[model samples]
Target: MKLPASGEGDVSPAVHHLVKGSAGGVTALFAHATGFHGRVWEPTARRLPGIDGHALDLRGHGDTVMPEGYDYPWAAFGDDILAAVDGLGRSGAGTGSGPVVGIGHSCGGAALVLAEAARPGTFAGLWLFEPAAFPPPAPGEVQHNPLVEPTKRRRPAFPDRSEALRNYTSKSPMDAFDPEVLAAYVEHGFTDEGDHVRLKCRPLDESQVYVSSLVANVYDAMAEVRCPVLLVQGAETPSGRFGKLTSQFPDARLEAHPDLSHFGPLTHPERIAASIRVWLEGLGTRI
Candidate 1:
């Protein structure tokens, strides 16, 4: 099947994506986690059979461009996913036998849950991979971590596009990816500035994004999701935190992989795809 162009323009100053799959069955819309672009799902998308797929670059990440001083909030991200879903429906991709599936990784998973909760039964099912749902740091317990909070609060300015790409690839957990994969990420993760290039995500903005996750609550929203939920977690991941609440969903099921890390989708896409295929088939949803 022809793979449709996956990136598009959004009205909210954010980047949108819609990857078409040739499966001619149910359509799946996937969102990537923080620090990664939507294309990370490409490997898994290629592995699923009989289904068309769509992946979006959430605001402030990947190809999505955000306005200056924009601190991405959890609610806005949720709205953006909904917009992507509506865009697909309008594009005539919503037709087929099965319900539309919303697949999300890390914080993207939380956004999906919130979107579904905002509108009950909006998706046929949900496939989430270790959504990063940490409890809010107690009143004064929040500490400073440079990894999560870079020294320069604003988006970094590199000497050139190549330098920007180097900075991104050097710091990414996805450095282990093939050269081509790494290139694809760098291509979407940076932008040219005059004669130089810089990361599109500002340091302070990203820090705010992380903190937003800590305080956001999707439990009530999860309860509202009427669709079946398939949670694929890294077994090595300790229990508690968000992992402990996996069982709360009405029809939720969990699958833990012993060797994968938080970045399983990038590190082990094939396995993630295989597991998703099995789960999708078991759901008996059309295409």
Candidate 2:
């Protein structure tokens, strides 16, 4: 899939994406988590037999040029995803199968919710894996995100691609992920600088996404997504309980994977794919 600077009524930086599978198959639009690009979704996408997958590299993250001011909040991200979905539908593929499915992990999943909210009937179904959305805050309560400061201080450059890959593959949360997924992350997550490769998404920019978490009405937005929804979360991850959100929709099911954590989608792509495949099949068997 090509990157369009703007579509579906909004001007923002173009979103980069990759496509796979036959055009005749049902279209599956996927969004990645924070700090990663679209290719991270490949391992999972490849496993779905009859679904054409379009995985996107969101703003400031991949080939998509990051706009100035680091102000592309969650609302902006949702518009970007919505435009991409329209771009795919305009391609004249998978019309017989109904609206495409929306798949997202972490912040990506939250963006999908905003997209479906902004544009009704954008998807036939949704598959969200531990999306980073929170319920209504308590009375006079404050929310302090732990990830912002750490992410801001994160190292932004590596001596070499090998070192970057090694550092990532040898780490904890990332270390547990599939080798192929990690490779894809490193490949699309950085660009070459003069003497080394710097991260495409600078630490500040990545943290900005985390910092802007509460700028939108996340809890209220859940009602806008009324399509068949499958909510998947790691049993052990905090903020994974979304029973309240799921209950708001007419057709929604929640699943908890006892053995996984927040990064379940990346760590266990095959297992996650199997679960999603079953849901997609229930939506409509691919030709």
Writing each residue's lDDT as its tens digit, candidate 1 over 1-287 gives 11222222343323333445554467888888876667767767877866787777777876666777766668677877787777666556554555788888987898898888888778888999887555446688874444455534544677866665566567656565645456666676677778777676666667777766655777566777878888888755453544555666777878878677777777777788898888888887532
| Model 1 C-alpha lDDT versus the unseen true structure | 0.70
List pairs with backbone clashes in candidate 2.
none
lDDT of each: 0.70, 0.78
Q: Write down the TM-score of every candidate.
A: 0.82, 0.91
In model 2, where do residues sit more than 4 Å from their true spots? 5-19, 91-98, 236-240, 285-287
Please report the TM-score between candidate 1 and the true structure: 0.82
What does candidate 2's lDDT look like per residue over 68-124, in tens digits?
Answer: 566657887887787777665555433345457889998889888888988978888
Measured by lDDT, the strongest candidate is: 2
Specify the highest-TM-score model's number. 2
The alpha-carbon deviation from the true structure for residue 203 of candidate 1, after best TM-score superposition, in angstroms, is 2.4
